[model samples]
Target: MGKGILIHLQDVNESKKSSKLDIWLDEERENLLCDITSLVKIESVAQEEDPTSDEPFGSECKKALDQFLYISRRDKMESYNHDGYCASAIIGSSNKTKPEIGIWNHLDVVPVGSGWTYPPLKCTIKDGYVIGRGVQDNKGPAMAVHYAMKYCLQQDLIKNIRVRQILGCQEESGMRDVKHYLENEKAPNYSFVADCGFPVCCGEKGHYNVTFKSRNYFSRFKELSAGTAANMIPDEATAVLVTEQGEKTYQCRGIGGHAAFPPGSKNAIGMLAAKLKKVIGRDKNYLDLLEFLYRTASDGYGRKLGIACEDELSGKLTCNAGILKLEQGKTILSLDIRYPITVSGASIKKQLYSEADKSGFDIIKEEDDPPYYMNEKSPFVQTLMSAWKEETGQNDEPFVMGGGTYARKIPNAIGFGPGQDRDFSVLGLSEGHGNCHSADEAESVDNIQKAVKIYVNALVKLDQWVGKGMVNNENI
Candidate 1:
């Protein structure tokens, strides 16, 4: 099978010793931990952008980044900002032609979505886990990358390498802030977002935020509102039906999960609205939309519409009727769809509307994020995998993921470590007995160490890979 391009853990250890990475990392671990704790202590919530003020998520996020970069400023490092939406700090000798490597991370975190056993803002360390909201999702990795970059620059880890660390503020809701920077500024050469799991991520499915609204559908529907964000499915859906039986409250509740995996969900928004419509005398549009979505979304049909594209790595398309709202005579429903890489947004909309026309429901399109894919054998994937093997001794293969990250926003970018493989346990990654994005999110000390080492080592390999003409910059 092409000689199996996998490196063992022993080679990683020997290389670490030869490079003196372990010794240098050991000397800086305590300082790094302190910085990580401080960063996590600042609570950066995703709120509406204010044109007048500089601090949108409050000054905590901006303050944390400012303090972190203060060290760089003392060393006379290069830095820049974009409307307080984000900040990027860089350190290295002047070399523009060299492959500019970047470590991407977000500083602002999702608002504490209720259900927290401990305070979501404060960093709590108990049972060897730092319990907090941003501890795992991006804060931990952000801190780790910042410190790793700091150490690399101070120690001159890799000769003739340029590294930049970009911390994003509005990553939870949208990346318009980062988009503005890219349009107004320049893009990185080769980059890795340390926000997803390892062995590595080579692909991200297309994201479609579709809105369906029609004046005729659900004539008896009074009020409708479903989800919080386009990425999360609605756990609880509530609607008031103005039927002949008088106004009735129709409610549907389920455990909300990521929109990328919509099965097993009770579909609070869809079920409640549909059930209310059924009670008030079914509308063809309502019934058709429900049936079409259930059948097409679950893979029983609608393959021609690119709804059934599946791979051995990432699973099939996941659809969620997340948002619902009715005003005057018009009813609106927002659907969060994550289609496979093989699917296009146009094909999906055409198929959904082709069925919608028969039901008399008018479809309106909203946001669209194109699908992203990378070769599993690409240099970026190989270097990340090699670093993971060295850190954890796991020989895992790269794969695609359902959730989207900053990696997809830019070319030649993929998500690398900070999260463990399937077999490894991340006890403190979150407070909800899981890792990332969930409530009570935390980061373990041990996992942080491993993540720092992996990222640093990967950067080292990246330097060599670019020098040897292994990475293809034309894709960027």
Candidate 2:
């Protein structure tokens, strides 16, 4: 677990300026904590084995969705569940002349890996932070949006706008929940996903998942297994090798993070493969594959594969070998790649196939999703950035990201904050302490409260901006 600068709850209250929104947030802070705590205790990790016709992800996900809808109904907001994939709570009535804005969030969390001092399911409030699995990645922000909408409803501030908070249960696995929801409903013309950083995410790189399989035997390697999910960097990996003396076990450890941002976390599968290459020598075909992974795929860029590239807006292409396993005499390696927005999926595939042919591996399966980009000069992007700047007093420009969010799913959506770069630089704390998808995930209480205020301001501003026809509806 990463250590963060501990702050007391009192410090936040003292430092914040007294404003109507801030005062209201201060008064409702305890209740907000209670809401998050209650929701986190349900353990809403999606499981494929537990899936049913009624509960697509699992019963735990269904439980989380049901609980969220229950809270929305109690608050007197209109709530609806789309089968079992997703649920939504509408805070305001649609105005015939105004555009509806959607706030997208996820209820599902990643599996709780080992090494947690606090229980992963219990939302622990200590040292002015909410510590839990979903607190940082999504759950906390979802709750914040819930309260933001509630605030809008209570104040009757949503006169000419409609704000719908859509919570999905399959963001971690694949975005099937949102897909199902879109099938039944039209895409919101202007929306924001509260699953990323502030200053707004105007561009997102393309996403690709590729799996390599080889049936050829490894003479000296017996078994190898590592990784939890395709979208997360593997933190730990183990390999059993048939050595000269006997079977030998080896383990490698590295920091894990979301694959989109690989600089912060290390890849354990790459580490183990590099070590095994030295032991087994590079002459073997298996060692050759390991060498390819360690050299080209280990680093964020696709340097060794000769496909490393970048663009001015979305930056460089990144590749993470997230999953690796050797079973039933078949070795498999799964890669998560985020390519530059300017790059074509067909070009990337051709390059990958050429390299695989030379490296003695077959492409078992591949999935490609094109990049998503919004013009920074557009009214929608500017409005979101302006809202963030006004609230935080930060003048940083809107930037692109390698991570994919619900923003990509929605027609005209971008990723807005529950995180800010300053949280890591100035405050000595990263969102969730920079432990998303890793053990001991957490969210700062101060950040959560701050996010609520930002969301409230942004929603209010958007309502006025869109209601007045300041936005280009055609672009959306």
Candidate 3:
């Protein structure tokens, strides 16, 4: 997402400069593309709880981990799988004397959504861009981080700590994979999650997950279903109703996006419910459940539910009725809410619980992660921003975003980039065609190559700071 610091471009007449590192980077471009393609071919979407299954996340996630490690081993790199939840590829020796640096990226992607000309699973290369489900949001950046490790090694740019790239399997659904990871292994001293924009992300908004189940089943409706993930806005919703004539099927379509940034996204679940409120004709059979959906899901903000709030640093509090279905003869709604950094999770819960109770829905599940913020004046952040400035000749500063990255959970970590400076319009794709959680997700090849250079530079800088003023900044 182009949510990072705004970049100031140089004059077109000033030709771009090239270094020896860039020359070597060009040679590895094909390898990088092959690595991304290998991982993206698998539809690694997170699935529901399956206690009987062998893998922790799901079968597809297991396959993703297997393929990632197999490629690393085939490339003569040391790789490890953490019980099918996460996988790691290591470069250089491990020494506890120095900090162990790590790079975090996720393997699992959101469900393949509607409206796509290109296949969602295949990594299609067209017009200098890699198009697929997970290419832009994660898989493409994951491979870019992997190549940065190679570049660091080949140029002898590392001496302090071994570089490890950790790929987790559940980022879109919930961060259960991260909890399992921290329990089994040690957290990296100073690391970065390559899942956001550049120069660096100093703050990530708090994420509050809430679910509501209706008090009673709909007496007048036959059935209803929509959405697959908690973090994506529902694009289409279907409802079958017992009308005056007979049972009729009604469908509602709206724009979808990642719930963290829901400005232009319209909730189809809310749209359908609002229309049905008028169509139900004072029957009162499904009035209670219908009113709840219409009030909360009608807009991107949670104003109707009285949970809306905002602050300057992290922007507004966004809510999405991502999942709607019938379970145990009751209507259920899953919401993904991202609140401001200055707000407290307890306060949000207090407001949300009161509202849900008033609206006649019981809270079944709640997951909360408080906001994470790093001082912009810190040496670690300055170093990351320095790397970006050096690479792009821009003097952009650090920024705060709503997207909750691993930095919120990992110690001394921040959201770095495969920057959003890439031109997705290169392929002439229309609007709604190139976002992370939407269909036809893509990232430019040239953009990823540039990211490799930035990561290598950042890695080299991080390695040099192992012994110096490494105080509050653990890795530094």
Candidate 4:
């Protein structure tokens, strides 16, 4: 764990704080915790999709949506669930009008894997932190934005500008909730998903998800179970092999984290695949496929597949073999890749398909989420950066990231704070505890308290900016 940048910024910024919102936040801290706790208790992990049902993702997601709307109504905002695919809590207008700013937060979290000194499904407010599965990844941040909207509305700060707070049900799976909403509704002029690091995100790497299967049957391996989700680095991978001699089982363990940020995470699947390849891999139909995948993307860098590239903005391309399965002699491997902002998704896919075809693999499923980028110097981006600077007194410039957020799916939008940069000293950082997808995910209460203030201020300024039609014309 590293010393957080927020700690330094807070040390300097708190001394100068004198806003009425800040004072109100201090008074309402306990209430805020209650609301956040209520949310964390819902096991809103995505389940089998039922398109015909109102709760398309699952009952838990629907329950999560209902809870969010309930909280919104409690906060005196107009709230509605859009057939359980997504929902909204809006302020500033009762009349039908397009929103100027949209705040996106997801209720669904990745499946809790292991390692917990605290509970994974419910909130555990300990020391100065609120710990749970979705605490930092999204739920806690979502509530911070929710409270900010509440503060703005009660203070009569939201005037001509209408803001829509969006709660997504399938962010963990594929963000189908937001996709369905945008397909049936109009998006806000400017939106920010508080799902990334503080300051601001000006660009996001292109998201390329692909799945390839073995061309021939590999009957030796009966079962291969690994990874919790497509976007999470696998912590434990197990392989069961049926050989003439006997049955053999192989298990590999490694540190886990969100696949997009693979620095701290160690890939267990890659480890297992490498070990098996060295020991028994020979034919392209069997263990050799794992060897090929591990060799191509083991390090999370796309250097071997000819997709190794970087830009001045969004850094290097990252490739994680996050999902793998073997059923009925077919070997399936799925990759979650974040490519450079400047590169063409088409070109990358072309090269990738060629490589797989030559290696005797069948490209089964492939999807391209094109890269989104805005000028760092753009007035819209600077305005967001200014809000962060005012709140934290930190001068970290607006950045581009590999992590995909609703900002990429929404037009002319960027990602703002609520993302913890690193572990603050006061949180008493411990090992085996992680943030976002990792187990025992945590969010400091102080972090939430300050985020509300930051978001409240940002919302006010963003409303003004959007009202002016200061759109990023170049990107749009």
lDDT measured at residue 332 in model 2 versus the true structure, 0 to 100: 85
> Per-residue lDDT of 405-461 in model 2, one digit per residue for the tens?
888888888888887442433334432334678676777888888888778777766
| Error of model 4, residue 2, in angstroms | 37
Clashes of each: 9, 0, 0, 0
Higher-scoring candidate on TM-score, 1 or 3: 3
The superposed Cα distance between candidate 2 and the true structure at residue 368, in angstroms, equals 0.5
Estimate TM-scores for all models.
Answer: 0.81, 0.90, 0.91, 0.90
Instruction: Please list the C-alpha lDDT of all candidates, in the order they appear.
Output: 0.66, 0.79, 0.80, 0.79
The candidate maximizing TM-score is 3
- Model 3, residue 276: displacement in angstroms? 1.2
Which is the better candidate, 1 or 3, if ranked by lDDT?
A: 3
Model 3 lDDT, residue 204, Cα: 92
Q: List the residue pairs that clash in candidate 3.
A: none
C-alpha positional error of residue 179 in candidate 3 after TM-score superposition, expressed in Å:
2.0
**Model 4: lDDT to the true structure:** 0.79
Q: Predicted candidate 3: what Cα RMSD to the true structure? A: 4.7
At residue 369, candidate 4 shows an lDDT of 93
Q: Where does candidate 4 have its weakest 10-residue lDDT segment?
A: 1-10
Higher-ranked by TM-score: 1 or 2: 2
lDDT measured at residue 135 in model 3 versus the true structure, 0 to 100: 93
Off by over 4 Å in 2: 1-18, 49-52, 94-98, 281-283, 422-433, 466-476
